[model samples]
Target: MKQKSIYLIRHGETDYNRQGIVQGSGVDSDLNAMGQAQAQAFYQAYQHIPFAKVYTSKLRRTMQSVQFFIDAGIAHESYEGLNEISWGVREGKMPNSFDNEYYRTLIENWAAGHTDYPTDQGESPEQVANRQKPVIDLILSRPDENPILVCMHGRAIRILLSWLMNEKLATMDLYEHSNLCLYKLIYSYETKEFTIEVSNDSTHLLALVMHQ
Candidate 1:
């Protein structure tokens, strides 16, 4: 089996993120000032990794979070598959409003093992895993030794992490996920399996240790 590394990161904070608004795949926003700083700090710390390619969700935030790499001429691609879990009508709404009561309930249900629950027009967690898993399989099928970087959203990263680690998709968000936090997975070709090397890591932020 070929040994490979995959680095995953959530997009930087957007204005909506700071406002505690919902930003599913439908809401595309750029990184705020603090988000930009976090991105820079992440790059300064891990720029030495020699990534083979960079992949990001189609949303602006994911791309913005890793803009430094793109600016430095790293090979990159945007995939719709990496987009966040769709929240239906709550895409641009606040988290706790009456309209999003169902949304909140759905997520709580998801956290509590009801993976099939979703609000009006929203996507089930299963749908997200179906979309993200294929991309992961394709990347791991390659016989190269180069590492890869994937910049995506919080919920999507959680789903991807669960899928990659062969864990129950129902508990994808059991771990903490901060904006621009990193997760690392190592793939063993001989065993044709992936292992978690790190999860929800923000050590690169140094002084921003308290940052969410």
Candidate 2:
């Protein structure tokens, strides 16, 4: 049985991340300086591996994170399905306070697997999975023997991982991913199953983080 491999990576940190903002699909911020360096490190770390395909979200942050691969001559594609869940009414606004009751309630609900509840016009967890599943399916169906790199947002990544693993969305809380963190998954074409080989790896970024 031939196994297919995929590398899922969250995009580098954005200015909003530094500001403690909750950005969603509606936000299209670019990578901050540290984020750019992290992306570079990711590229350097994986330069020796020959990737068959590279996919990225339409958002600037994700696009920027994978730009290093492009600069190194890797061909890649972009997809809107890879975009983060739309934050809707809360797109650009910072919460009134860290403990804002309403905002905290929404996050808590999302983390608890309330997939259908939308927070301030944002797409629910189910909605995010709906969009991400198709892209993942497409990747799994590819016939290529080489690995594929998927560049996307944190929320979308979590949703996709949940769907792929047949786990509840709330399980995402157990995984703490940082900027440009990489996860490797192996897909079995015969059984349509995927096994996670690694999660949230940032050996490439350690030096960069220390330099900051």
Candidate 3:
């Protein structure tokens, strides 16, 4: 058993994000101009880390977020397990008052321990975690691929971290995230546990913030 370092990040913003539209697994969108700039910023900051492998959701946005790494010849892989949760009826819809209230109630339900409750035809937290199990297992088994970079979506990241940290799905909101935010974790094979070294870090985007 060997220790491993995981550099997990949410994909950069898309037009859906900028426009406040719901983009779940059902929608496959490309990164907007701002997203491309964000990807460049991330690449500039982490280009020297010597990542062993890069993993992304099957969605193009996730891959695009880490394109620089893939272009640099780093081995890359995509998995459905890393895809964003399907928003079902809400997918690609701009929020209206009704949708806003629906989400508020959904979050409240989730907070009330009904974590398995799904959106209208969408995935539940438990369902997402189940699909992610195999991916996490595979990553843990491959010790040679240390210091891997994983680009995934927002809610999926929260769910994955909850599972890795032994936290209940209802508490996943504690793991807040933003586009291109990094969450660095260390896995100890000996202890069979994950330590969150960095949580929701966006320091690399400071220059972008300053420029804006």
**What Cα-based lDDT does every candidate model obtain?**
0.83, 0.83, 0.95
Query: What local lDDT does model 3 show for residue 67?
Result: 100
Q: Which candidate is the best by lDDT?
A: 3
Q: Runs in model 1 with CA error above 4 Å?
A: 97-101, 209-212
Give the residue spans of candidate 2 off by over 4 A.
none
* Candidate 3 lDDT over residue span 71-158, tens digit each: 9999999999999988899999999999999999998998888989998999998899999999999998899898999999999998
Candidate 3: misplaced stretches above 4 Å? none
Model 1 is weakest, by summed lDDT over 10 consecutive residues, at 95-104
TM-score of each: 0.92, 0.94, 0.98
Give residue 56's lDDT in candidate 2 (0 to 100).
94
Better of 1 and 3 by TM-score: 3
lDDT for 187 (candidate 3): 98
Pairs of residues at least 3 apart in sequence or in different chains that clash in candidate 1: 1-189, 1-190, 2-189
Please, what are the lDDT tens digits per residue for candidate 2 over residues 46-141? 978888878998888998998978877778888888998887887777768653887678778978778788867778888888888787777776
